[model samples]
Target chain A: MSLDIDAVKNIAHLARIDVSEKDLETYTKDLSNILDMVDQMNAVDVTGVEPLSNALDATQRLRADVVTETNKREALQANAPATEDGVFLVPRVIE
Target chain B: MYSNWETVIGLEIHAQLSTNSKLFSGSSIAYGAEPNTQANEVDLALPGTLPVLNKEVMNLAARLGIALNATINKRSVFERKNYFYPDLPKGYQTSQLELPIVEHGELFISVNGEEKRIGVTRAHLEEDAGKSIHGAAEGCTGIDLNRAGTPLLEIVSEPELSSAAEAVAYMKKLHSLVQYIGICDGNMQEGSFRCDANVSVRPKGQEELGTRAEIKNINSFRFVEKAINYEIERQIDLIEDGGEVVQETRLYDAEKNETRSMRSKEEANDYRYFPCPDLLPVVIDDSFIDAVRGDMPELPDAKKARFVSDFGLSDEDAAQLTNSRPMADYFEAVVADGVEAKMAANWCNGELSAWLNKEEKDVAESPVSAAMLAGMCKRIADNTISNKIAKEVFEGMWNGEGDADAVIDAKGLKQITDTGAIEAMIDEIIANNAGQVEQYRAGKEKVFGFFVGQVMKATQGKANPAQVNQILKQKLAG
Candidate 1:
């Protein structure tokens, strides 16, 4: 089964997207097509095959544990929506 | 009937690896740093940034896995757990889902001197989230990203624990192991080592389990025990009143000693886990594992065994001496100073331990250094100070007088082990206490004690007790 409009709306809400009602139908149709492709891909049975974590045959690089990062507060926090007392401020979230 | 209910407990401990830098970023992992100062482009989750794993984290994880007798998977993958929170600048946390570094380990815990084995389900590497300082602003929370991207190994345990005491034992054992292996600091106050407990109750002999409530962020061992017991009793009482316990995340109110439902965290959605495309899988070869094993420090159990066999110490004394690395080092240093092994163990496990317990200080913070203690213990071993005189010398040393020889010389507390001096003192006592001597000759054997006391008192209580006793015995017999 493909995704429905209501399901798409709930997902958009969870993602904090401003999906208008008109766009909801389009997103539902578009998402359904993507799910249909995924379903087709899942049809192949590979029970004993190990799951692939990466496409590359190489492993990850390891870095020495050292303080290479310096205080770039002025440059980094320049992109934040709000900051004060050297911290990014947001609506209080308890727990 | 209520007592028959079986409680199952499993703990998830998040131990921050004692690395110099963050897990994926080169940002300093030092605590109490000024917020965003430590956050670099990678830690800030900026676009077009990639992550490189810290080699120390893997080595520490391998050390812990080997210490716990866990299997180290050759290949482990990191996944992104999608969630939204202000403190988490990135919309997802990179964690291990399917393949973790360590798996299927077991550790032993002693509860009331009875050891029990608890299974370690798995331990995975993950980055820590930033701290959310609530009410720091008007109707808002201030986020400190200093702790963000810090390396943490989340250790999950099997639900085999039955009681709160057993749960505490398991937590303590894990804590000591992490600290002993030098992977974690085991500092709960600083949030280095944190615990979360999954507790549930079921009817006796029931094959199925009741719904579990997860108590999150229990920072202290005592708090873990208290919180688990409270949750268990609450579940039992709720079921007894025909209520069903729902699966939820609970917050421990340490001030009230209760676990309350955190409906907000519960409302959070499911974490969609997918392998991170930005980072490749971690593949540890045999050489890497061997290197980690070689770097592993001696664990507590092995140290304890060595102390017993090498030093001929009793099991209890060995346990007490090797309870911590610093204490064990002190014990060894004292013995290395030519003190008898038994005497050093006695002084270390007896006097030093009692003093530490009373003053509430760790051996690392002891005012007496190992060399200083060894100096004092040397005097007792060589009979420079008798056992009784050594106490006075120790008191002087504790009061900052000096080391054993200094204190003994400064206070004139050195034992008079000279046989000739002791004989002269005994003769003087016999002549002065003629009546007591007569009583001793007339079969009043207790009079011998009076003469010995006179000798000790005449010497200002510094007479070698053994020598004094022998001389008094010979004089009284004559």
Candidate 2:
């Protein structure tokens, strides 16, 4: 599938990236090339084969349901850019 | 005026699993904790943090699959649904995309005595995002990551429901089922169980589906019904006014009882979904499935049938009793303690239920124990106390008066079956009410109630009503 400027701009907006007019042409070409390369797998005529979702065919390893971790609010919140009263603060989000 | 439109509804229910820890992290999953106290490094998406799948989530999901009679996929994959929200610490939700864990399930709901089968498309495991507390900080949003990484089983239903009532019934049945299987707590108030309803209206007997709108995060069953109804009417009104229903996500303002568009389709976020690379495919062997099935409790439908045939309860009573697992357990406990099934069912569904409703308590939180109720039922059955006196005793018990016998003794509410005492009262009533006695003997049969009432009043209402009637009838005839 071919990528247009508007489509690229929409994708950039969804990804929360700011795309300028000068970069739009480059982004469209790059995204289209990526899609085309990924679409190359469609050339195989394996209609009945099940699609693979994971690279490793291994089953998922399960952990016990116990609460092995303790409260680390102070340590975890140390990485936040902004925090107040044990909450990570952000710009006001309106519904 | 709009008889040409038909409402079609389907529901997607997100039930938080009742596990102790988060789905993919070791963080504690307890609710109502101090803000951010439950968030660990893994939940915070710190560098080098990896997610480990909890085994209990699989067991719980398998239990739900068995309960719904769904086909359990042996292998299921976890995918990353990418979205930008302040609540999502990882910037993507780990959910099952194309291959859900359970699929092709069906639930039967009765709407106005018409039974319809609602098809369950799939039930997939996903991680919940954190909470964004608005209006808490001055012109800012505060995020609590306590709910982040929590497990949710999103059960999606097919577009089979035709009305608001049907959709509500379908939701109630699914809610009860998940709670019954012990997979979810089914607490809508705390949002452990919430639903998003997809509703659309079309011309009657039309084959093509119309554009649908989704009502999001409706937490109550009543709101589900009301929101669907309001949306249906809105769509019909729009179509009749030469407008088309726009596909969008709407928010149900429960206080106002109306649905307003949250965002139109063009502004909808594209949740670019792809399989997660961190986690492998979840594979279940036959033995694991068998163990989960073996550990399953009796489901609601089976319990309802057993209640009908084993206890000779009416279908309505049985259905009511088995709607919740705890209620069914309470009823069975009362009967197990030697209370007659029919009488026990009556007291449980009647007086006990009424008292519970008044106190706004669930069966599990009932103040009166099953043994206490059985004791009261025994008194009523053996003529120790009349049903009316038992109600008064129940009230006393609820007020912490004591057990049945203590309440009866403290209140002097026992039935008086003494024939000699009843005879004395009857003779006095006959002598004093000479005019009424003459009226009764002259063939005014209704006056018999007057003498019985007087006898009862004289005995302070302790007289056994049947014994009072017999003795009073004999004295009046002679």
Candidate 3:
């Protein structure tokens, strides 16, 4: 699939990024190249191989269901841009 | 305008696990906490933090799968679904994309005495996002991360439900199943369990499915049915007007009882998914699955069957009693206390259910204990109190007057079984009600009931009704 400037703009908008007219062409080319390389991997014919979902063929390590962490709200939220009444504040999300 | 249309629906339920901690993090999973207080560094996705799979979550998921007769995948992987939302601090949700933990499960639900088997496509584990509290601040939103990392098992069902009632029945059955297995608290108000319904309509006998609109976050069973009905009518109306149904997400307005479009499909988030790098694939051995199966509780279906065969309860009564584990347990406890199974079933489902409904209480929080109910049933069996007087005694028990005997004694509600006293009362009634006695002797059999009623009134409703009937028949014949 080929990428166009409009598609790139839409992708940018979906990613919550602002793309200008001048930057749109550049982003389209870059994203197209990335998609082309992924297309190259798709073109290789593997008749009988099972697809792998993870890099390593290992099972997940399970942890006991216990609450070992205590409340660190003060330290954790220290770097937040804004907070009020123990909640993080952001520009209003209507939905 | 909609006579030719057939409504089709499917449901996706999200049940929050009742584990003590968050799915991957060590943060407490308690609800209604101070904002962000239950969230730890790991839950916030801070740098250098990683997620570890909680063992209890897997166990609970397997338990649910087994209860539904679903195939438990021995191996499953977690993938990151990338999306942008303020509540999602990680910029992605750790969920199962390809291989869910459970799949192809089947559950049977009955609507109007007709049973339908709804197929479960899959159930996968995922982390819940935080809450975006809109209008909490002026021109801003407050975010509570306390629920951000809680575990949720998203159960997807096949689109085989034909009507809103069937969808509701399926949802209720599934809700009770999860609660039966002790995996979820099933509290809709607190959002412990929630449903998203996918609805569409097509011309009758049409094989091709119509585009479906998903109504999201319907927290209660009643709303689920209402939302689907509204969506179905809307689709049928649109189609009849020569308009097409656009696939989209809708929100049900509970107050208005209508579904409104939330977002169209074209503008929906892509949710680019990839296997999560931080967590490894979850692999379960035979022993783990066995352990889950071994510890599984008697599910609803099995309990219903047992209630039927063992207790000789009617099918409807058995089904109703086994709707929840607590009700089934209460019934069993009453029967185990030596009350006849049929009587226990009747009182438990009849009087107890009615009282519970009237008082707006759950069977679990019933004021009358199972033993106390059993005691009352025993009094009825032994002719200590008539059924009518037993109701009065029950009212006293509910008001905390005491157990059956105490209530019976305190309220003078015991049935008088003495033959001589009843005979004297019958004689007095025969002497006083000469006209009625003559009417009764002259082929007016109905007047006997009047004599019985009079005798019962004289005894203040304490006469054993069967004994009164026999003596009144014998004395009047003489």
Supply DockQ values for each candidate. 0.79, 0.83, 0.83
Q: Compared with the true structure, what per-residue lDDT tens digits does model 2 show for residues B289-366?
A: 999999999999999999999999999999999989999999999999999999989988999899899989999988
Each candidate's lDDT (Cα)? Answer: 0.88, 0.91, 0.91
Interface RMSD of each: 1.3, 1.0, 1.0
Candidate 2: where is the Cα deviation over 4 Å? Answer: B264-267
Local distance difference test, candidate 2:
0.91
TM-score of each: 0.93, 0.97, 0.97
Specify the highest-TM-score model's number: 2
Model 3 bad stretches (over 4 Å):
none
Write one digit per residue (lDDT tens) for candidate 1, span B293-388: 888888989999999999999989998887777788888888887778998888788777877798888888776777877888777767778877
lDDT (Cα, 0-100) at B219 in candidate 3:
89
Model 3 error, position B66 (Å): 1.6
> What tens-digit string does per-residue lDDT give for candidate 1 at A1-95?
49988788767766778899878888898999999999998999989997787998899989898989889998888878889989998988866
What is the lDDT for A29 in model 3?
89
Report clash pairs, candidate 3: none
lDDT of 2 by residue, A47-76 (tens): 899788776667789999999888888877
Classified by CAPRI criteria, candidate 3 counts as high
- Deviation in angstroms for B113 in model 3? 2.1
